[model samples]
Target: MVNKLEVAWTLATVALIAGVAAYSTVLLYHLDALPAHPDEYVDVIGHQWFWEFCYPQNVSKVGCFNATYDPTTGATTGGHLWAAPGSVVQVNITAADVIHSFNIPGLGIRLDAIPGRVNSIAFTVPQVAAGTSFLIQCTEFCGTYHGTMRADLVVT
Candidate 1:
């Protein structure tokens, strides 16, 4: 009887450990933990000298698409806009030269844009203030100018 009890205790302890580990794994990747609303668009563009942003646009239409800009002023054809609440925002990120990261702490969005590959991130902003904006920073070491790779994301 003592031996059987010892074996049962060992099995129970192993099961408990496995259950805890499985729970941790799920919590790590679960998107439901994100505090932002269920639907909000967010984007981050990394260039050599500047960072560009596309507000909460239709996710179905974003990806390696061509963008026109002012030749002299260096402005985008569409223009920079703010994210709105209750929208499914998809971010299409790519790099011109080196690797760069798009990070926004408020919305818990971050992704790396590789030189020859495109990466994407999707998140929804649950609620947004008219004038509230999040800060964007480079999470990769690009070059000397990497420190200035910052932009503002406004949630309107």
Candidate 2:
């Protein structure tokens, strides 16, 4: 004595949900997969009020550098995140003290930097003129000077 239309509608809704779930699971898996080979690799260490960038592949000299921001001048000195234009760069991110979120709004890239844990992400640098730069910022509420925690990704 149940209504046939109701049963049909219920079954259709269940099928639609199941299909979406399966698609999402596969999409997420592929999104997290890293490339087999990248042009460059950078180690990004997040501090409470600054960011440290290290290039392990550089063998000539000590590749570690710290980026300090000057609030008065709105400039960053000491070091910068460098990459070649149109190159694929992979960044291994971690935090020294607390959790932080590394974000580059221009390229729509964001990743969490967790203490004692390394999170990796890869992206291609846009084919732009040399010296082109992007602003890097911390989206996480780290500490008192967190707002000043900024850097630049300069294309070399």
Which structure among the candidates has the greatest lDDT? 2
Q: What are the RMSD figures for all models against the true structure?
A: 6.3, 1.4
Clashing pairs in 1: 37-125, 37-126, 39-87, 40-124, 41-89
lDDT of each: 0.64, 0.94
Best by TM-score: 2
Q: What are the per-residue Cα lDDT tens digits for candidate 2 across 1-156? A: 999999999999999999999999999999888888998889999998899999998664258899999999999999899999999989999999999999999999999999999999999999999999999999999999999999999999
Per-prediction TM-score:
0.65, 0.94
Model 2 C-alpha lDDT versus the unseen true structure:
0.94
* Model 2 weakest 10-residue run by lDDT: 55-64
Which portions of model 2 miss their true places by more than 4 Å?
A: 60-62
RMSD of 1: 6.3
